[model samples]
Target: MSILETTASILKLMVERQGAIRISDVIHHLGMPKSTASRVMSQLESYGYLEKDEIHGTFLPGPLIMSASHLVNRQLTLNDHVDAALRSLCERTGYTGYISMLDNQEILVLRVIHGRQSLPVVTWPGSRSPAWGTSTGRALLARFTDTQLHDFFASPQVVSQLTGSQQDVSMLVATVARTRDAGYATAVNESVADTASVSCAVGDPATHDAVAFCLSFPQQLATPEELQRIATLLKEAALTIAGKTGDTQVSSPL
Candidate 1:
């Protein structure tokens, strides 16, 4: 889509929903770059077309959307579809489901569903966490090719933005490679001490709309074999969610 078309599409997505939206939402829906989404959103905010919620990290309709005669069209909100998928998975598996999306080097929790077992670590909707340590983060990162992964993690910043080459990209790439081989990703004592998670990436990484379906709980809840079974279910849900979000090009489930 052209820049104008892209901007219009994102704005439409924002106005169509009653709630706020994040840059990650625009990326997921439109397959736009983080830089581009930021730029467009900045422009919209400056023009009074959008308002930012600093605390919640979301965007809402601004003065222009409130008063202008701009066209409002219906489009499937990608985050909505993912959130629903997470809910269904949590119901079936009895595990909390997190709908997470990549926003640069961080993974943002877009939705959260509570299962029977409460997580030892707190994860709230719209919370931002490290992509390097969490299964949800690694699952989304696994979408990148090795070279892309290296470039993505070139900087060792806690945020992991491509800056000074201080990060252990090799190790991250190794973990990602394992995710590629296993058709899923897992974490133990990485995101939070004594917490574990299993994750699967949804849709194509090339789309720039990277998302992951993850189930997190206390570390001792499952053994390797049991975790595999849950991972199987998570992978299936992630795959189905790709089609639901209108992104049929998904990460390989095989």
Candidate 2:
């Protein structure tokens, strides 16, 4: 990797670990000469991307990191709105709720709410779930171009469920097609056993990225009629969230 890329990789590692890393550690991770790593570290330090604690002799994220992240998280209000929306959805529906957005190749859970009655499902905040295997992921996948969809299907991350309900790209694509036609997506025990969810995309008002609001319930509790009503609520809530959040794209779900 180029020096710049290497520096960025190092920065990402440190941020993920949330721990101080020494110069020797950086060299060991990168498998580069000490002199090269030292040069890269010096440049990063000069650029205010990293700071070394003199006493510990280890580097940590510098002020610039927080400033840049603040600008990003500030723009989406991702953290702020996610928790509020999740809580409101769970309260309204009496089911677990979550909001997710496509982050790179993964669907990232921004917030989650567990309702009063405990369900068998296991989920958490800031969790990363596969976009190819869940209803929320399929909601976004339906909107991708043919080439993008093909590329995503080719990736190894996509997996077939043991439930024997749906398998292969054709079936998944067909499901997305139906979701696009219906203006929402639903999966019954697709991700977790005995748990189902319905989701609708939260279109960005500005850049038009596909975001989603999801409601999850026990398989027995989520009847067809209930799902139909929940679908309406989810659609309306997603649009409301987008409008209130100043999302850029005004396009409704298809």
Candidate 3:
């Protein structure tokens, strides 16, 4: 691979780990010669893309990378709207609500709003969950074309992990189809046992940048009718956010 590509990969690894990484860890993980890895590390450190801890002899993301991330986040106007929608959903349903998006084959939680309940599901921003094992993941995945689904299932990031009744790609495809048909997705004891959730996709499908709005509650607390009601509320919130963002192409599950 090109030097630039290698450097970017290393940076991504550091970001994913969210902590300092040793030079040896990079060399071992990337399978690069010690000299080559050292050269790359030096270059990144010099350019302020990485910072080394002198005492621990480990590297971490530097100001430059953080600044770039901050700038990009600032430009994401949709986050503001999504956050407001999450709060509104939580208030209406008395259930914890979240926004998630697919990132590197994982479902990355972007924002969360706690409801009136005392014992809401505990998931933090920046936490990731298996894409095939959660309501939000299924909701987002339902938007993928057949070819994209195949490619995603073939990737190394997607393992043999099964959630709910999905044992193979065919079952996963069927689940996506059901999610599309229902205008939402549901996960009961899939990601976290005894937890139930329903989610709907929001944003323009053409941009391939949709996010899922989800309502999570204790399984025992959610009757069949309550689940359906929460799903309706989630869909409405998603549509409102999509409309505000001028994403008229969002598929209507209704």
Candidate 4:
């Protein structure tokens, strides 16, 4: 292959794996001369397309590549819609609002909107929590099929590392069922001690990916009335999101 083709292939590998790539691995995979591969890697690093670990002698995607990836992902996903909804929810409730979705067995926060409160609950994009312990997690999990749920709980090692009190598989199954029936989910001092959250799933079950919108507050501060209001507002916001996405199955709460 030409030098340009070789460089492109190497960069593709780095982007796809999202981890460090060793020079030897690149050489073995690409069948390029050591000298040519080193030259290409050095040039790419100089331009900030790749970063090298001095200690491990491995190369990883650099700031420029990651930024490009982020831009592409933001454009491809429902990031803008979810971000706008979270902001509006935060404004309406004066509590921290966030969008989270299941990532494997964990809940990954995609966006967060800090409330106007002086001591708002702090959360950041890309943060992860236990799937079985957070309101958002449960809300999205409620959409999983029985077989999918069984497969998720089949791995004890995965379940053991989850953040809250250890729960039985039967208990988790029951929780999912309840969440499905309730049209929303609640977690009080579960994922994080002293924190309370309520969430509802967004988008159509068949068309779009499982996602949830959540609002969180101090456990001691969340009153029954406040919780109910938040749940109602979350459902409304979720419906709006589903509508915007052209999901016709808007009859379901989740």
Best by lDDT: 3
Give the clashing residue pairs of candidate 4, or none. Answer: none
Regions more than 4 Å wrong, model 1: 1-75, 156-167, 204-208, 245-254
Candidate 2 runs further than 4 Å off: 1-79, 159-166, 205-210, 244-254
Candidate lDDT scores, in order, read 0.74, 0.74, 0.79, 0.77
lDDT of 1 by residue, 1-254 (tens): 77668767876786455368999999888788899889988988898878898999898878886555333212435565577777887888778888888776788888778998877876888888778778888887777777767766764555335235355656767888888777788887775788788998766332446678788878898689868988888777776666444344354645
Candidate number with greatest TM-score = 3
Tens digit per residue, CA lDDT, model 3, 46-66: 998888899999998788977
Name model 4 segments beyond 4 Å from true: 1-77, 118-121, 162-165, 204-208, 248-250
Tell me which residue pairs clash in candidate 2. 202-211, 204-249, 205-247, 205-248, 205-249, 206-248, 206-249
lDDT of 2 by residue, 45-79 (tens): 88888887889888987778768756765575544
Task: Give candidate 1's root-mean-square deviation (CA, Å).
Answer: 14.9
